[model samples]
Target: MRYLIVILALVMMAAPVYAVDPSEILKDPVLEKRARAISKGLRCVVCQNQSIDDSDAQLARDLRVLVRERLVAGDSDQAVVDYVVSRYGDFVLLRPPVKGATLVLWFGPVVIALIGIIGLVLFFRRQKKYAAEINRDIG
Candidate 1:
């Protein structure tokens, strides 16, 4: 009885996920695959962390619809992405171009990591020098 109750609760929780209409299936699976691939690379402007392909937000859904609309209209993959990027700026792309404006975003992490490593090396070297001084004093 307890197991049956738990299963029923799980089923109820899962039901809302199927709210997407049955007709949402793409007529051309190949085009749909390409559309999904492109959407996966574009960030959801409203939800910066989630890709448009992965986000459940209305804006993401609309962007997804736009992607499919362009694809079916005979736009090449690069053309589709370029259209979105032009409208939203390079920030919309998961991979931004390596350019002057985005230099910090591209290289900031490596620069910080190098600084941190240098700091650690200096600290250890200073600690060793202090230990040597203390040893000399004791002798």
Candidate 2:
């Protein structure tokens, strides 16, 4: 029983989690692949954290359909994405381009990490100086 449970756990862990429905799949393999790649970069407004490809939300389904519709109409991948972005704003993109107001979103984490590192360095220096004063007084 333990061995069976372990095997099941391993199988589950190895599987990729996605919410693509059989009905949603495009008939053409090439177009389907492109649609999937585009869907993976879109955020589901309802799910918030999950990409549209991994989200079961109705909005995600609509967006996926929209993506396919645009693809079918002969729009490039970037153009399809831009159309969605135009309708839903940049928030729909999981990785929005770092331009205009999004520049902060791209660099904010780095700035925060630098601040933390600077704070840590200052704290260690202060502790070392305090230790030296204590040894000087003791000696």
Question: Which structure among the candidates has the greatest TM-score?
Answer: 2
How far is 5's C-alpha from truth in model 1 (Å)?
A: 12
The residue-level lDDT of candidate 1 at 125 comes to 100
Write candidate 1's Cα lDDT for 34-137 as tens digits: 98889889999998987888787888888888888899999999999999999999889988889999899889999999999999999999999999999999
Candidate 1 runs further than 4 Å off: 1-24, 46-50, 54-59
lDDT of 2 at 75: 94
Q: Write the per-residue lDDT of candidate 2 for residues 23-47, one digit (tens) a residue.
A: 8888999999999999999999998
Clashes of each: 0, 0
lDDT of 1 at 86: 93
Predicted structure 1: lDDT: 0.87
Candidate 2 has a TM-score of 0.71
Error of 2 at 3 (Å): 3.6
Error of 2 at 135 (Å): 4.4
**Shift in Å, residue 97, candidate 2:** 2.7
Per-candidate TM vs. native?
0.69, 0.71
